[model samples]
Target: MFNSLQDKLDKALQNIQGRGKISEINVAETVKEIRRALVDADVNFKVAKDLTKRVQDKALGQNVLTSITPGQLMTKIVHDELVDLMGGHQEGINLSAKPSIILIAGLQGSGKTTFSGKLANFLKKKKNKNPLLVACDVYRPAAIDQLKVLGSQIGVPVYTEQENLNPVQIAEHAIEHAKQNQQDVIIIDTAGRLAIDEQMMNEIRNVHQFVKPSETLFVVDSMTGQDAVNTAKSFNDVLDYNGVVLTKLDGDTRGGAALTIRTVVEKPIKFISTGEKMDTLEIFYPERMADRILGMGDVVSLVEKAQEQFDEEEAKKLHKKIAKNEFGFDDFLKQIQQIKKMGNMKDLLGMLPGVGKAIKDVDINDDAFKHIEAIIQSMTPEERRKPSLINISRKQRIAKGAGRKLEDINALMKQFEQMGKMMKMMQGPQGKQLMNMMSKGMPGMGGGFPGMGK
Candidate 1:
């Protein structure tokens, strides 16, 4: 994600470290380094120059407080400037109209179809709206099929007319279908081109005219860097899009498009697509992004993701099991599954405060639990329920069945034992007191036992 740019910015700020105040020489060095970093990240030279100038002007004008070091003060100033450059506040999509229409427009391979399905899933699960995905990319039969496949995966109905060649007609007919079917939202996925062509622009314009969408989003591939910004400008020139969608942010983007697109097009980035998964869509927040860019983890977003995936009813049931000393391998496997559903392992861990910077260079694979899951699946129901009964011979058999080594099975057993002991401790008086304290401090930790406090 912007690892290179982050490193460069960190080094730039280090120039003023241990200094008593922001001196002219130090400010010049810092601003120059900052400008160089931006240019290296594929940002436009003019934009980088202008932004650094503003940052320098602000840095020199402010009175330096005696308590803070020059580096810390400068970092704060730069962070603020970055946020301002990226649209100071978060902007939400307008879904006020009944069957609110959202038209997706972008270049081909910009992830428009995938984003449309993700948006439908987000609206259905997060906003409690019945969304129908409309496939208007008639030029490519495969595109329509892709949308249909994604729609099926997310359990959302997709509206498409195979015989319809005109996207405007398809969108209009889809809207009429949504009204009749009581679908609360209609997301029309239109066709796109490999580049900015006149025919493609006119087709999208026709769809926009007919649908009159509450939100028209221009999706762009962040990996394209400056090209992404240029394409965004071109799209906005024709359609005047309401917002931007930056896709593939989980890839090695140089941070150019994210930093320059908002300033270039004057449109807030409404959503960011971190991965191809249906649940990978996230609302863009300028302050949080600045924190991430500065190597500070985004704890608020992490907590919100945890809350979204936390199941109250399931937690209650799990609490009863823990109280009965019945926390078994099955329960442990289920917990791992729930965590996997939250997001990628490194992404989830990086969201914790202080963890992102600590593990910046470490590689954390999302498939870390693959062997453990295989081992658990190899166990019989009785063995999973009563893991204590498994002897060395049984462990060998399980390991052989799971295609793993004996030591791996033993390690898993040790972890399970530790988890069981922790659950039992949570059933005691001291654990109850700890639970009460944590519940008072954490809003989502207000249940009976350890597992219950999701």
Candidate 2:
């Protein structure tokens, strides 16, 4: 993430935050710091300068309201500028054609193959499109295999021609196959070279001309910093891509490409790929990204992720069980599974307003719930439904089966009991009041999840 840039921006904004009013001197100082922060993040110097200049102009011209501090005004100006620097709004893929073709292009090792799989998965799951993954990388045999593996993982059909060395022909054949199979979307994964070259460019250009894709995306590794933006510019000059895709955003990246690629290449960033997971692709939202960069977090995206995993009937059933005091280990396990489906635990926590900065140094393991899950799985069906039936002997057996210590089981039981009691309280008349108090005080609780001791 842009943790480093976020820290720098925070410190920069602090200069004008407590001031009584916005002044030319303070604005200049803050804008200078902001420029330096962008440069440090490896943003193109010209783009950085132009953006900060706009921010400074807006900051000085704005009238700080009685309710708003100088820092607040300045931050708003910068946020808006950043949003405009990226695309101001989200740009979706164009899939209106009967069989919309999306051509994926990028440098070698830029996660093009992986993103093609992810895009296919996203289209199948979210857009309700029957997508066919066409492996057009005739130069790399391994790429075709990788596409096949990913296609299998996502349950999408991958079209590959091991004997065919012409990508344009492969793509043309895949389209006919898609039409016959009733697939509505075709994502052709084109080949890439280590760096820009004439032969690679000619091959991809020929494929692009033959496919006439509804959308062409240029994928780049976000961790490459300024170099990523440069590569994007080179590609855009030739292909004039419809949009850009930033991959490997979860890496220890300075986030230069995400911040400046649109400005340099004049293309909207349509998608961002965080991890290798097929479900980890996100439609790019410039506003939410600005919020995250400013350490404001992305609550809307967090809620969207939660809603994707939410089942209305399941919730009603769980609520009924909790009201009857029947919530047990099985229900708890199901809740944990839903949370796991929401993506990485640390990333989910980072979506909270202030939690990202607070836990920047704290390692929140993705497997934080594994021990709890193991202990629950070790219980018998009856024990899972009625934990009260677990006597001391049963506890020892369950702990041994889970390869955990007896103390771990005891701690989990205590936490479960507390959670049950809390749920019961939530069902009562004073539930809202209790929740308010808990929201204010839970930060001081000084404990991790059940079985994860402080």
Candidate 3:
């Protein structure tokens, strides 16, 4: 994410970090570096200057206590200012109305249609709302089909009037359909229009007026940088949307749109779409974002993601298996699946405090478990249930079956044995002690990673 900006900010804070107290000279130098870093990240020059000035003033005004260093205080000040810069608190969608209407608007290629599907899934899963997705993009070819595909993926019904070219009429009809179907939420995916297109803009306005949505979100591609902010302003001027949605945020290393859009559009960032996955949508939290941008990680969000994919019953069963020394490749494969459901590998790792910077340059592929999965899948039922049965001949057979080298099988077997030993130890009387020791030695790594044992 904002890896470059985070590194720069860390360096900037280092200027006053080791100092006894905040001094004007050191504060000035640090603030200057901070401003440069912000500008380099594509943040608005004025916004960057205004934020750094506030940080400097706060730093100079503070009297450092013996408990905290100047660097810690300075980092705290900057984090707070950054939070304020991006909307101080999270803003949630208003779904109080019976079948609350949410209008999605944005420029073409802004991931509007995909976000609509994701939003529907989020509401269906998180908000416990029965959402009906209305595809209102009459102009774009296959736009309806695209929405239908997404709707099927999320198991949400998409209301589309293919024969009816009029979006307003389709939306009205979709509302009636939602009422009849007992749907409590209607997300109208409007056509993607350019700010300069008066006719298209007017069309979206008409739909907005007709629907009177409880939440009108303006989606923008965050990787567009300042242009995303400017486009948001243009849309806000016309529709005055309830909030903004930043899509493709995972690819945004500079984070200009996330930092500047709220201040420019005067709307809270309601959601952030990090990837193409329907479950990748997250409620925009300024504090959490500021934490991530400053290399502090977002442990809370990470835990939430894990919880979403966690199966309590399955955990209990796995614990029993571990205690019995019966944890096998099949159980390991299921764990990998659950982790994959949590989110992208790199993104999941980046949520740990101090891990983001460490893995900034590392390519932690989403399909990192591909080979392991293949190997596990190639094993017979007996082999999966009892990996100890896979002798040298079995290893060679499995290797050929999985299209892998014999050494790869050997490596996996060795690692799996080590993991089994660790699990057994953790399930024993000294489990808690072992966990504490591991945590102290490697914070955020109390549970060793899958396929990561030596």
Considering summed lDDT, which 10 consecutive residues are worst modelled in model 3? 445-454
In candidate 1, stretches whose alpha carbon ends up further than 4 angstroms from where it belongs are: 18-22, 65-67, 426-454
lDDT of each structure? 0.88, 0.90, 0.89
Give the Å shift of residue 202 in candidate 2. Answer: 1.1
TM, every model = 0.91, 0.93, 0.93
Clashing pairs in 2: none
- The residue-by-residue lDDT of candidate 2 on 1-454, one tens digit each, is 7889989998898877967766688779889999999999999899999999988777766764333667777888899998999989999889999899999999999999999999999999888889999999888889999999999999999999999998988998999999999999999999999999999888888998888999999999999988888899888878988999999988999988899998888899999999988889999999999999998889899999999899999999999999989999999999999999999988887887777777777888999899999999999999999999999999999999999999999999998999999898888879988778767876676423343224
Q: How would the candidate models be sorted by lDDT, starting from the highest?
A: 2, 3, 1
For model 3, residues 158-255, the per-residue Cα lDDT tens digits are 99887898989999999999999999999999898655488888899999999899899999898889998888898899999999998998784588
CA error at residue 43 for candidate 3, angstroms = 1.3
Off by over 4 Å in 3: 18-22, 64-68, 433-454
Rate residue 236 of model 1 by lDDT. Answer: 92
Kindly list the per-residue Cα lDDT of model 1 for residues 231-284, writing each as its tens digit: 999989989989999999999889999999988889999999988889999999
